[model samples]
Target: MDTYQTMDVAVVGGGPAGLSAAVTLARSLRSVAVVDAGEPRNAPAEGAHNVLGQDGIAPRDLLAAGRREAQEYGALFHDDRAVTARRHDGGFELVLAGGTVVHARRLLLATGLVDELPDVPGVRELWGSSVLHCAYCHGWEVRGRRIGVLGTSPMSVHQAMMFRQLSEHVTLFVHTMPDPDDDAWERLAGLGVEVVDGLVRMLRTDRGVLRTVVLADGHEFPVDAVTVTPRFVARSDLFEQLGGTLTAYPMGAFVATGPMGRTDLPGVWAAGNTSDLAAMVAAAEGAGVAAATAVNADLVAEDADTAMRARAERYAVA
Candidate 1:
């Protein structure tokens, strides 16, 4: 590996967005480096669905391929976690966990989201397989399967309604939540969803395939799918340290960004789930492409101004 004095782009996180940005910048003839912590929140996920042509690829396999593709394009992959980021003279300086320093002209935060699932047993096992999160992502594959929409709040009422579009045999499990409003109740009944008011004990499954949900009342309900809106915590603490304000989301807080992932702070950009709470892997990659292009343009403008000033200085010296 060539010892890089400075990188044109420094992408944090090795997930889809970071890899996509690094690859694009490298192809554009820029030195790029990706800092990844080697842990994805979706590690337990059996496969990444909803990715066109690459559906059903395991999470690790998908990331491995991304890393390989980016590396092939001369993008350096740093297997260390970036702990601190401060604005430098030209761009930003990052301090990794082990005191490694990397200087970059631009930054991309692609650190993905972490889903805080329910405290119920077997959730980790069933998650990303029979137990799912996004309806648009995993709904089609689980169509016609008996599904349960576990309620963490009144929002589960809407989730149950959405899943009804996929299957008529959907059940809404109201785990420890109070009764829904009249309108919420009406929506469920109108959708023909079965509402259960018992705490979920365990989501019994087999080998990544789901079987049924066992409730605390000792009632085992046969369910082929379990949909719960797992809580989320943003993966981008680096952005927060840079004074980027986060907006509150129903699931979690995420870095606020412009259309192309440019944050309020200059020289620092964010894409993927770190900023886009609802973006899929494909969408995250697209966002990264857009952000990288914008960052490159910004840097080019900066370099042009610097060159013009130097020209004036030379003319005066003459």
Candidate 2:
């Protein structure tokens, strides 16, 4: 590995959160570096919605623009995965997949979460197109169409209810999820969502357009769009080197963090999907800005203390 170069902050992941943090830190005159492996969770999606002022912007375009903005401010970006990290000389050093090492005084773990999709056919192929997860993200576009909510877990009930608001014809396919309780049944009935029994054999599509959902019993329900609840898992394995931990929720697990994305470990912070699994692109960007602000304040305090100590040593020498 080459000799480690020092930086003020290392932002990992290169998604909306990472780019946002790099831009903010670089604008503040801090030496910032971003490490990303180019695998974004939303890469399959044609466009990212629900991000104000950037609604419907292609995910790649958004990241490219953010990268250019940060580069204009002298922020360095490494197109490699940070495979390992450890505490070093009162800071942290990260080893990338490309055998380069980087040391930084503070770290921003913005590596977002991964969505584990259901083990069903055609779901992966049509994902981010006709098959979706979030109603707020792609509901409006498919409104008034035949929408199907595949049952992967109990959470599918909520997904059906949310999508029902956007479409009149909504079906809840109990493919593999446990049977709904009385309350869930009541809610589904109230929302006018039809419940289908039996495991889903596969999704039927024609010419790249979703057509219907086929059950194991050969029952077919016509559908124009579908939604599934995928398990959300944050990319926090590298946090082990810093003695950081994650917290588990009903939906998934994420790194634990306090206000301003401060983690339990000193000199380390987390933001975006690393901590908030429910955060969208816009929310993740806001969290990155907040964390950057806090990090900058901390560096300012450390700088003042160093300056004072240097003055004291000079006076003693005189």
TM-score of each: 0.92, 0.97
Could you tell me which residue pairs clash in candidate 1? none
Q: For candidate 2, write residues 4-23 as lDDT tens digits.
A: 57999999889998899899
Task: Kindly list the per-residue Cα lDDT of model 1 for residues 130-217, writing each as its tens digit.
Answer: 7787788788888887989888865688788888999989998889555788988887888799988879888887775678888898
Task: Show where candidate 1 strays beyond 4 Å.
Answer: 1-4, 205-210
Off by over 4 Å in 2: none
* Model 2, CA-based lDDT: 0.91
TM-score of 1: 0.92
